[model samples]
Target: GAGVSQSPRYKVAKRGQDVALRCDPISGHVSLFWYQQALGQGPEFLTYFQNEAQLDKSGLPSDRFFAERPEGSVSTLKIQRTQQEDSAVYLCASSPRTGRKGYGYTFGSGTRLTVV
Candidate 1:
C-alpha cells in the first residue's frame, strides 16, 4: 500500500549533461504515468505504462527524453543532453486502471530539474 515516490525532489544540471530520475509506484497498481509540468502550468502527460509494457509515449517532448519500466513497477526517466528549456517538474503517478478519470492518480512530489 505504498504511495508513489520520486527521488532528488530537486535536481540541478548544466546544459548538455544527462540526468536520470527515479520513481516508485504504488504496489498492485496496473498503470503508471510520467508528466512534465512547467511553472504555473498544468501537468502534461509524458508517457504511460501498464505493468512492464509502455502503452503510450506520445507526450515525450523529444528523443532526448526516454523512460522505461522494466520490472512493471519501478520506472525511470532519463534525459540526454539536458537543455535550459528542459527545466521543469517531472512527476510520476500510478493508478489502478487505464481509465484514471475516477480513481485518479497518486502523484509524487516531483523532481524539479533546473538546467543552467
Candidate 2:
C-alpha cells in the first residue's frame, strides 16, 4: 500500500454527538499511531499499537476516546458525547517498526472533525 489511509476526509457533528473515524494502514505495517491536531497546534499523540495489541494510550484526553485494531490492519477511533473542544483533525500513522533505527512513519491525510 502507499501509506496510511483515513476515510470520510471530513465530518461534522453536533454537540454531544458520537463519531467514529477509520484508518487503514499500509499493508504489513507493524506499528500504528493516532494523534489529534487542533486548529493551529501540532499533532498530539493519542495512542500507539503494535500489531493487534495496543501498546500505549496515555495521551487520550478523556474516557470518551477509544481506539481499536482487531485484525492488525484496520483501526477505528471512536469519540462518545463529542464536545466542541473535541473538534480537530484525527491523524493516523503507520510504520514497519518502532525503534531507534532508520525507521520512518507514513501519515494519513487525517479526518477533520467539526463539532458544532
TM-scores, all candidates, are 0.94, 0.96
Local distance difference test values of all predictions, in order: 0.95, 0.95
Query: By TM-score, how accurate is candidate 1?
Result: 0.94
C-alpha RMSD of candidate 1: 1.6
Q: Write one digit per residue (lDDT tens) for candidate 1, span 26-111.
A: 99898999999999999999999999999999999999999999999899999999999999999999998856367888999999
Q: In candidate 2, what residue range of length 10 has the lowest lDDT sum?
A: 97-106
**Residue by residue across 13-42, what tens digits does model 2's lDDT show?**
999999999999999999999999999999
Residue-pair clashes per candidate: 0, 0
Candidate 1 segments exceeding 4 Å error: 98-101
| Pairs with steric clashes in candidate 1 | none
